[model samples]
Target: MIFLNVALKNIYMFQDAKLDLSYPRKLPSSTVENEWLEDFPKINFKRVLILSGANASGKTVFGKVLCIINNYIAGSSINQSTSWLDIKKVMFDKKKPTSFKVEFLTPKTAQAHKLAVIFDQDGLIEESYTCIDLQRNEPQSAMYKRLREFEPTSYYHKTKNNHDITNAGFTSVAVSQGKMKVPSMWNYRLCEVDNTSGSQGRITAHDTNIIKTFLSAFDSSITKVKSIAAESYKIEFSNGEHVLIDKGKLLDPDRLSRGTHEAIDIAMFYEAMKNESFGESATFYLDEMLAYSHTEAEQSILNLLIDTLPRHSQLFYSTHNYDILDMNLPVHSHVFLKKDKYSEFIQPEKMGYNQNDRSLLGYVKNDVFGTLPSMDAINNL
Candidate 1:
């Protein structure tokens, strides 16, 4: 399952923001072969999303919100998704309901699902769900025309003093179909690469080679990586000295440079994705853990990840590196995010950039879309 679109109102920093993953209708779909399923070519979704923006410009917040929605759909959403969110922005004080509208496509079922929810401080208040069919041989025009006219199947609202949201995830009609075809049938894996000093992961023997090879590419001093225990390994250097990672803890982590430290974390991430059983359910959300790695190395791995994505999977990557704008990615594949009074996800293709010959990097560097850093405070200081 891939999310085609997500809209938020009164959720954390978002006042009214929408992130649409579907490819633009105005642009030709000729270069987006990797963007859609082979059987469902009419649904041109944006498979690879390279989110680049200024600092604190709502990049990380967007991913966290999406993860919360994913968790809520799976019926395991925790309060932590909004635990640290701003209470004022959440509208709890104003007694308004935070709302979300999601549209996703399940390739296996050859159908699409749109789920809308509204909840207040008391808990969930209302929910609505709708399902649509997409035949394999359906014409593009017919499919899009039906999409615009999709009517909601059901919408429910709670009466006064009804606050228990535990029995609620989807409406009654949505779950009546035996949980297989409903939104809950499928699950997604949304992981953010947190590469702090004390990060942990079990690295067994089978993954030793892949880990070693990827790390060695960044640092030439390492000779071999041997699994000394169930979750421990010794990264030996050519200088007869070595580093120890026991039970997933990198002891003496400061011995390595910052770049080498990032490499270790990325090695684990790469190994996991390389061997993952990706399908409709496995989605990836990667924040920039390559702050210390070389640009070329990052680009190579980025390309590899895009090339290896299964037909039904999607990758949402976030970064502040302006160098990434120079990559050969399509304008539609990139979204420039910025903050004014409210956060917005600006699509380059929709910003009147229908022509593919323009330089996205140049436009961004010139602050054309207002994604560059605002210097009002700095200038005053």
Candidate 2:
């Protein structure tokens, strides 16, 4: 499944906000080769999104929102709770419901699927799911809906669809077993790729080959990656040196830098993709992906993500690196989050800037986008 858009209200730093990744009605003239999905030509959809902002500007929180949505849709136990204590407290007498709506597409269905949920400090206030007929541009049908005060119902026309009401699970299993093919979702944060020695450490010969390919792209010196045993691997380098990884512990830590650990984490994702571990279509959420990496390595990884990720997959990343602004991504691919405020997309042309001029550094320096940090207080200190 491909993500189209996400809407949020009274959730953390967001207050009635919408982040639309769907292609603009009209593609910006600056769009170039390999920037968009080739199969979905009719729909203007971006496969890569970069969220950048100041230290406390909600970039990571926004990523967490997406993670929460994914978990809910996947029928994870995380969302079946009776109440939510993590909601943002309302400052005024009026309390707003913390809600979010996500829209996505399934490969087998012609309609777009939507899931919306509203909750408060006490519990879930409302939840609903519907399908929209893209061809007719109308609400096609209501799959399932539940209001806090009313009994939940699964509707098909006037009658309830018993098959749809099976309390087994929601979108996750239904999409996989049903006609629609839901997209797989993966989330990565700092240390997850480096320090965590989870299932990712287990590898097959094919997986090792795939990891080698990505590692080679990032560092050609990595001649081979071989799984010696469970949770252990051997990496041979071009300089006739070898390093061993035993149950997530790396021998000779000085040889494999933090950047390599990050790269290995990414390579494991590639291995998963090759093994069809994430399903047909996938969405990857990476937070602070460039941490501890130098400029050249960052650029190399960025290019790797751009060129290597499966065509059907979408990558959403949050970073503080200003160098990314120089990558010349289409305007629609950028989202700027302001602290305690709303997030907005930056359109290069609308701001009277040339896309090819690499003016993002200048724009941020001039505070054109308003996401830059105010360092005046630091100077005073």
Choose the strongest candidate by lDDT. 1
Please report how far candidate 1 places residue 59 from its true position, in Å.
0.8
Give a tens-digit lDDT track for model 1, residues 1-381: 788888988876678888888874535544434576678766678878888888777777777667666656555433543443222344523567788888887877788777887776645577777777887867655665676568766555676422343444323323443332533222122224332110122224347887688778888888899989876889999999989988766898887777677776666655545543333444566677676778888887777767766567677788777777777677788897788877888998887874665568888888889999888999999
The reply for model 2, stretches above 4 Å from the true place, is: 25-40, 80-96, 136-183, 190-206, 209-224, 236-243, 247-255, 273-275, 340-358
Q: Which pairs clash in the backbone of model 2?
A: 1-183, 23-44
Query: Model 2, 180-279: lDDT tens per residue?
Result: 3344455444333232111322334446776677667667799999899875788899999998877646787788777776666666655554445555
Please list the residue runs of candidate 1 whose C-alpha ends up more than 4 Å from where it truly belongs after superposition: 25-33, 80-94, 139-154, 160-206
What lDDT does model 1 reach? 0.67
